[model samples]
Target: MWSAPTTTAALLTHVVRGAEEAGYNGLMVALTRNADASAQLNELSEEWTSVHDVTGQLIAVLSPDPEVRTAKIRYPIVYECAAMHDLRLVPPEDHDFGFNRCFVGSVHGDQLRGRAEAVPPRPPQEHRNAWTEAASRCASYFGITEAQIPAVLLLSFAERTAVLIRLRPRSADSLYDLCKQVAADLGWTKRAAELSARQRALRQRQHHLHRVVDRPELSRAKWRSRSADRLGSRMTDELRAQYDGLDRHLSSIAEVNPALVQQWRARLAELRSHGTVEETYRQLFAIRRHVIAPQDRQKWRRLAAKVGKVIAATDRVILGRYTQFWNLDDADPITAELRRQEAEMGRQGAEMDRTATEARQELRQIDDELNSVAAELGDIKPKHDSEPGLAAATEAAARHMLGQIDTDTVDGSAGLAGYTVRVVRPMAEAPVEHIDNSLSGTVFGPMVQAGHIAGGVHIHQHGLWARMRRWFS
Candidate 1:
């Protein structure tokens, strides 16, 4: 389906032949201005003359170079003639097609035309190497070692300062070890004197061991404040504004009920600092039960439960490891095997907690759906119950009519006279229609005999009264 020819002429010839085989009326031929493409000029002349009698059109592409080199070069030429005997070329000044890249040569009815333009060159490798070398030298000048240069460049200066703690020389004398013995001894003595002087200056300020009694109340309040501050600062401006609004809402509540924020902060702080594992659980549950509304209580309860489970699971992991060690205390032969088993269980406990949390979330979603369905049912009750009211009325009317019916002769024919009178009473008794009359025509005709009505006309009389009452109501 595709071919890469050695020469532009060979490629163009192939393209032309392929186009002709494919039944094309026009051919777009592209050419490069090199020795490889020189053969193309002759090929194109031959193809043009051969196809002169044919119906197809031929177009040639050329580079912009006036003095074309053997390598890759493209530029515009101005001295080329426009009119010739065999083939005439029309040259246009300042064409959008730049000679720096590639140009087109069109041949149709002995008219040959070519246009050239310049193409943009790629940046050389020497420039990139120079920039990289400069950047590396600058990085080294700022105390960044070759090994740490990449991290220093990517992370902030504060982060770099923190990492520098590990990079500090454990002993200043170690650097001098590479020197001569006398020089090393002299350097070590000088460093010791300097360190002694520095320590003396620092010792004058305060005692090394002093109790740092942070007020318990202040510490707890700071925890919530810092957490909220971190949450806001990490967000974008739009989200920060939303958090600001929440903070304002809390501030307003704090102004009205100063204990509201204090209570939560105090409880949280106590849990974080002094409260035992079990004490924290009790405090959290107490908050959920007393402070939060019932509807919101479940979420807090779930959070507390999840946290408790995680803590307990972590403690179990440690306890399980300790149990393994205890078993190994009595048996030396399988100590390594027991320890491995303990490690395996500890790892699995964390994994199991993760799986349990995911399953809990899924069940919570199901619970929410069920609650929603119950609420929807409550909303649908009135409408669902109202639909059957008319049917009940119709059934009561039919029952009353059948009960009141008496075989009485009016004039020469035998007929029921009390049926219509009983219909009014049933209508008064049941507000909805009788169920029998609401049935199909065939069902109503049978019900007329069953009801002992004065023909089928009065069989549906109660139905009309029920419908009228419903319409008015």
Candidate 2:
């Protein structure tokens, strides 16, 4: 379509009629810049610019560019064609109409360019012949026909002459073939060089995309930095208004769930002998009553059930009487024995309380003596403030060992005997001690002979401390 502003109404009629004959669902009739129909179709052109419409089919258009008016505008048009054919224009965003539509333009280059200079005459037939030969040479170098050149070439020519010669490549497959031939003609003779290079560049881009997609650690760190944007800073906003409204609806409840913060704080404080978990759960449930509706007291009920199961399991593991403990249905003699034991425990507890008081006094008296004896020897058991970090470094070294289980770290060290595990906190009073035992034909021979050791007895722990000290030093 070409535009003389005076002829746009007639051109639009022709375009609309042609599109109807071609069975298009809709047509986008475009015009040159400053043309009479520009204002009439601005909304329509904007609508056609987006690829997807309501029905998930590609709406047909010249291209996203407002000036497209020819069949050779193939980059956007061909992609849109593929989408229309495949019905892949799913409405993935808002403001979508339907997916199947078309556009026609009636615009000349002068009007599009917003100029009134006299159009330069076309080159004579001699120039056309020479250019054709040059195009053929370029095409032959790339082992492609002249028709396979990309549409950008025509757009370049249009800019120079205001004469848009349509350029329609046969297909993407053909264009790819031409690119390969071009690379070969340009002396990239290696196998699939151009395609491989492009693929490598694309792969690098995709890898960067994958890194971004997989970066949860970085996301959490960024969230920490931007935490000032959190709810506390925006308590007067619409979001807060909605939150308040929701809170009003839930205000009649007697209690919400027991706060996890309080529970963890209690756990941190009470580091008594193991099996304290059951005691914690029991104390939590004793605060709740069964009279409340299940919906209101569901959390307490769940805690009670979980604690009961744990207690039942512990009894089964240690006493080998899971059913009797859970059902409260032991045999008569067993029941009698339990009752007797309970009574005896009550009496012994009182006696033990008195004994504990006296024992504390005695321990105070001998504390200095005990300290002197302990000072005479090296530390019996090392302590670590960050126990879990020490444990993790041990794990990392163990993993390293597995990779080198059949290989040595350096020199000719073999088996687990050559490694010694050690942990050093970032800033702390002392490092965790995992002494090696080189004498027992095992990794920790010396440590075992001098004294029994607990914590950090992994195979990779052999002699690692010496190596770590060497590295640190």
- The candidate scoring highest on lDDT is 1
Tell me model 2's lDDT, rounded to 2 decimals.
Answer: 0.29
How do the predictions measure up, each by TM-score? 0.14, 0.15
Which lDDT tens digits does candidate 1 get at residues 289-407?
44345454343333333333333332233222122111212323134434555576577757755655665565555456556655655665564444422212222322332233222
Which residue runs does candidate 2 get wrong by more than 4 Å?
1-184, 189-196, 199-205, 217-225, 229-473
In model 1, which regions exceed 4 Å deviation? 1-133, 136-259, 269-274, 281-473
Question: Going through the candidates in order, what is the number of backbone clashes in each?
Answer: 23, 24
Question: Would you list the C-alpha lDDT of every candidate in the order shown?
Answer: 0.30, 0.29
**Cα deviation of 375, candidate 1, in Å:** 77
Model 1, position 388: C-alpha lDDT score: 26
